[model samples]
Target chain A: MIIYGSERVEDLSLRCDVVVVGSGAGGAAAARVLAAAGAKVVILEEGGYHTSFDFKQREREMLPMLYRDRATQRTRDRLVNVLQGRCVGGSTVVNMADCARVPRAVLEHWQRDFAVEIDTADFEAASERAEAALGVAEIAADQLNANNRKLLAGAEQLGWRRSRFHHNRTECTGCGFCLMGCAFDAKRSALVTLVPAALADGATLVSNARVERVVVRGGRAVGVQGVLTEEHGDRPAARVRLEVAADVVLLACGAVHTPLLLQASEIASASGQIGRNLSLQPQLPVLAVFSERMVSFRGIPQSAYCDEHLVFDPRVGMTGFAIEGIAGGPVQTAGLVGASGRDHKRWMARFAHTGSCLVLVPDQPAGSVAADETGRTRIDYALQPDVEQRIRDGARAAARLYLAAGAEVVVPALRPLTEIRNEADLARLDDVAVNPDATTLLSAHPQGTCRMGEDARRAVVDSRGRFHGLEGLWIADASVFPTSASTHTMIPIMAFADLAARSIAQARAARTI
Target chain B: MIPEIDRRTFLRGATGAGALLVFGGALPLGACVLAQASDPPPDLAVLSPRAWATLACFADHAIPRGGAFEAGASDVGVAGLVDGWLVGADSRLVTDLRRGLALLEWGPLLLGFAARPLTALPPESAGAYLASLTTSRLGFVRQLHAALSELCLLAFYSTRSAWRAIGYDGPIVLGLAESVELERR
Candidate 1:
């Protein structure tokens, strides 16, 4: 059994029944399935195993320790700096524990439009298994943090329906460090859940390995070739290239990079639709200040959202949007507030009591992910006209809701406001030109980079995740998501991975017979 | 139908052929692996001394002792902390942190002027110097002071002490049993 941090094996040509790359939710799910089915599985992860004990609260140290690109990989085109985990648990280690089921409509759309024939019954069954495996459940009302309560208060004042959101947490100690890698071994990340289960069921995990290319022969994936990168304290690190033959190769590198891999392989020749139609359902945050100590810091990170205007209804498209409650520390708040000198001091002073809510808009699938001249990712996306208007309208609604909840000031991302001292000040937001260029837009759901469809010319992979016309090659991450769903994408991606693993297992059994 | 499938098949072949070309052309042993450097361990302390000083001053400002400014600005192993933080490992923010510290000389200048080390200066003088640096337009002093202040606040708030100072009731200590069990795991 290969636990994390094992010394290098001298030999290069190692064989395995299956090889899963990237130990995120999706990859981990697939690894567990294959290992449990009594297959020799070798899971290669680029990041090392990180435990809660190693979770430093400091961003300067922790960012490099846990996150990819050291948390400095900014969207050069947009005013957003994305952060994703690079450790054994992947993003799950640092993600706020919000587990929402895939919206039924999204599944229906997948079936009707995309030739993926997963019905409501199949989806429900898959979701049930995934939820059970993940220990997913709702947060009780009594467990609602001060931040969540304020969001509820605002929702109540606005006469909007609200309820506690579910999470994958088993016994959350109410630690504010969920978004910054939980220090207490409370949040159930893949590092704790699927990876461990997979290991226990006889899986071989090789950390510090980077897969460069998947070798294919006669339209079949033969194996993979990559380097194992290790950092020696001061000596200029070590790199050893690896060549492994496997029966099946699962690509779970993630949306942003999977397309790069495929493009590197020059595999999208049929229609060259390999890395197209990237959707980063961009989100903008709005902070509301209250006189009373909201203490928005201590709670589940994001537990609710205003769905009042959420539907196929175009009127609600950008009309109004606000989440349960979004909170962070003073430095993070200062970065967002973008004020210097005494005004910044004032913002920091009220940081303890400041209530924050993010307004997210489902960007109408308009972005493109392409490699630059230097072959690095160049994510270029412009807000559509309707999307820009929706942001302004949504921001205004958030301001009104805050004021209704007795907030003294509403600091919107793109509005000019001295402070909302009275209810009449809400009207000023209408004229506040919410500049899409200037306003902060972050993306958690990066999907459709490697889309699945009926036509091989249109999609990189088929409905079952197999690379189109290729044997023993499949993608099992957010890259396989044909389109972005309304809510979070982690659970849905993991479900799809589980389904893909089942298909691979059935194929393997059939071949053996 | 044949062309479409052939295109897909040909694409797969091209991918395989590309990998084969790279593998075939490369000098297997000496080329792929980068040459390892055998340089002496840097006086890790030498590179980041200025950054350490700035961070030390900043930490002092944020968590000074007593009610008074000079009297209260406290000091711990902040220099050592910053030094450790700078050289410990690879991080995006702190990659050239020591290099960035050269831009802020307020901490070093104050350290030079103090009756004792800036870490050991009387709380009153420390407070006064901090205030002057913030308020005065002494170009280098102001710039360095501002930088130190910013760096310190970030460092302090990010540490366990910030949580303690703010009365945040998050986890602080690990239980003995848990530590032992972790060792086993």
Candidate 2:
């Protein structure tokens, strides 16, 4: 049931009961559920289908194959790099496997603000089902890597709200290569689990097929049209033009592409929210080199977390953010630590001893994703002043936590601060310019591009992920999230995707399709 | 054998690991090698020899030579990386990069500094010139520096020699054995 576009010979004309336009957590999960319900499913992925066996564990090699545009996605100002998986598994394949539940507070806010109609019990049940489906498990204390242990110790020393992280892995080995696509098949990404299960249930998956636009007729979505980038292998020789027809069309092309596809397809949102209200969890990494070896890249990339900064009170808005551990491969480490040059080299030389944590800001929907004249995705995003100030505060907090754990020198600022030896230098973070243009703010979780709500005036989809005007069209990805959730988005998005897919299945069962 | 990725611990980069893509665009070493094979890399997709020299000079100045850092910019062939990056990029970006490098090369003489090419200038002179562009009153000049420096830095640091100088122990997994191998990904 898995078809490689590289090997495809000629034009394609396929039909299915459900045609999903992505193969990430949401799309794969939906395919599995819909296929299990006896609905013929077909999933189309723009990127090549790669798994652990093909993971060479080299950044330059893997990135181009696994990530979209080789992970060079840029915000309008080119300040932040938006990294999302482009392969068959979508973002889940490259994600750090940090799974978190939907905070009741966020659900309550959604119900109150967007009027999304899901009760607490139903939401919890949906989440529970997803967790079980994905084989979500807890990280044991014995398996804590040195990098993770340091953050845990630091958080404990600082009295931060620290806890273990849950991940979707069967027998993970702490190899710390999740961001590079797990080499041992330990991460249990959708490629290994949901996609396979769906395939087992007779689902068809087409790889390297970039859907140019959704084919609409008489205001009803009938199928998708796209081009096959390769006849085989990893070459960019556009070959076959693909045409896929389906009873139901699901847009799960992540936050960025889903909205862009909608616009390109000329699907009217009526709510003016096709690509509006782009919510993001922006990152500011605070690095500190310890006297002892941390070797932050040795084990699980994201083993420990501190949610203490998630200072949320629907009344006052989300004030604080999360601080977690992260270290990249050598290339990523060298490229991101500082601006070009000697000091940047100095930071890399100390890579082994450096312990890094990011201050994550749960941001408002303060941006838009637009395609340029060439049809490339560009995010027009800016950090609000208050969020910038909070990030500054969180950077200091993370630095202090490292200092509390006895880091020798803390490099908190992206463009080399004077080196923090004590609280005095840490306080200077307030003096540093908080310009989003200059900051090394990276957005990890992007949601709400085509948000779901009750009102068509402000939302793109309904509670069940149905498009406002189209009957057989739906979205089951993070694009439909109304607000940014306060944790890793994998579980919440899958849970919601499962919910959305269930609705589609019900419609088919009732012959509504 | 590669030790298993432990699912037991609470690993984190708590601030959702920054959303942005790290480093420059797809850095396929194949393309980089092919691009550099040309002399001064003429028929260059992005930079001419003089312009390539400007980038080398700027990257060398940025990292400089001293301390434990032994390799300079051209030693690792950053121009090649830059060329490959530009070949796949929009012509506008490649043109912008050319324009910026051209300014760095010729801007010195026009602005009444020493008449030496930027590549041949002393570190202090080169440093001062780059600093001027970085802090230039014209925001355009500053923006140009940002674009130019990013590619230079990424290309320079991407070198194995540079990584060695920085004491980075290469990739995390050297290779996985056959026992636990799955079907080709």
**Winner by DockQ:** 2
State in Å the error of residue A501, model 2: 0.7
Candidate 1 lDDT over B52-109, as tens digits, reads: 4444444555445433121212333444544554453443234334333432322324
Which candidate achieves the best lDDT against the true structure? Answer: 2
User: In candidate 2, which residue ranges exceed 4 Å CA deviation?
Assistant: A231-237, B1-51, B84-100, B107-123, B172-185
In model 1, what lDDT does residue A241 have? 66
**Model 2 Cα lDDT, one tens digit per residue, A434-486:** 55225556777888899999898888999889999887799999889887876
TM-score of each: 0.76, 0.88
Off by over 4 Å in 1: A3-13, A231-238, A313-322, A370-376, A413-418, A431-437, B1-156, B159-185
| lDDT assessment of candidate 2 | 0.74
The digit string of per-residue lDDT tens for model 2 on B1-185 reads 00011111101110111111121112221221212222465456666665666666666666655544667566766776767655544444454455566556555664566574455466677778777765666545555565556566666665667767766665545555423563353
Candidate 2 lDDT at A143 equals: 73
